[model samples]
Target: MSAILPPSQRLWWKEPVERIEIVWIAIAFVWCLILTFMMPYWHVFGKQNLSNEAYRTTPQAFAAKAQAVVDKWKVREVNGVPVVKPPAGADIYLVGRLWQWWPAYELKKGESYRLHLSSMDWQHGFSLQPVNINTQVLPGYEMVITVTPNKAGEYTIVCNEYCGIGHHSMLGKIYVVD
Candidate 1:
């Protein structure tokens, strides 16, 4: 007889479910309930949730804002990229374009600043290492996050999305001073 065929014995449907099967079913239902509640519970009390502070904006306008910060606070240039040192509590902007994170930032330890991020040409991922802050950088929209660095060191901002052939070269930096 084929495995797909029903059992030749009669009255198979009349048998009661085994005790072990009932216990397994109960366990699975309880697990499903726990999994369903965990997401909302974590969002209410999680320390590392993604910020929901984003807005629709044109790429031109966003670029203007980023350029204003670069022009005002640019202290130096490294590898042809501007390194801006905006004051604590001020706004800072980072732009992702073609293959780079433009105009790196210099921040002071324990001071908070509003950080704005946007993409100029394509979608990108903003991943700040050592601090573990990751956000999506989408074209024509701005993502804002408040950051307060607690340690004094150099941090790296790497693109976690594949943009193009030069995706691997798209790296940025942030310097935190005590």
Candidate 2:
């Protein structure tokens, strides 16, 4: 037989060290690209400068006291039917439950209302955000709250304070209309 040559041999330039170096260079390039899009490659944390005060009393008492200084609720007629209205300039309330809220869908599209809220069980949070207001709803007492729908849109009502096990999921929606 003549001299035989095996084709299984590799080129000398295809070295293991070169392959490892190439992989490391590629990983470094990808890390740099990712860091360019990140918020901070190097930075410092800052602290607040102002003082904040805490409120202890419920907003319902504040609202009632504040509104009482201005006006009071009275019995009136709507389309000849007797109704309870806000003191000339107040919001309305749709019934809310433990699981959800049932807004007053029986009224006209742009009607307003005032809520005299209370609970039968434990203390609950009555919060309407973007308005910077929250009230503590207590048992056996009607906590009146005021809201005005300046714009017709969908708003969220979040319970800022915890209730029980289902605390985080406690939420409601408000539908304002023209």
Task: Give per-model TM-scores.
Answer: 0.81, 0.41
Each prediction's whole-model lDDT (CA): 0.89, 0.49
Lowest summed lDDT across 10 adjacent residues in model 2 is found at 46-55
In candidate 1, stretches whose alpha carbon ends up further than 4 angstroms from where it belongs are: 1-3, 6-16
Q: Write the per-residue lDDT of candidate 2 for residues 52-117, one digit (tens) a residue.
A: 222233435544543452233434433332233343345443333353332322222344445555
lDDT of 1 by residue, 18-102 (tens): 9999999999999999999998898898645556889888889988999999999999887898999999999888999888898
Clashes of 1: 0
| Candidate 2: regions farther than 4 A off | 1-99, 102-112
Error of 1 at 43 (Å): 3.0
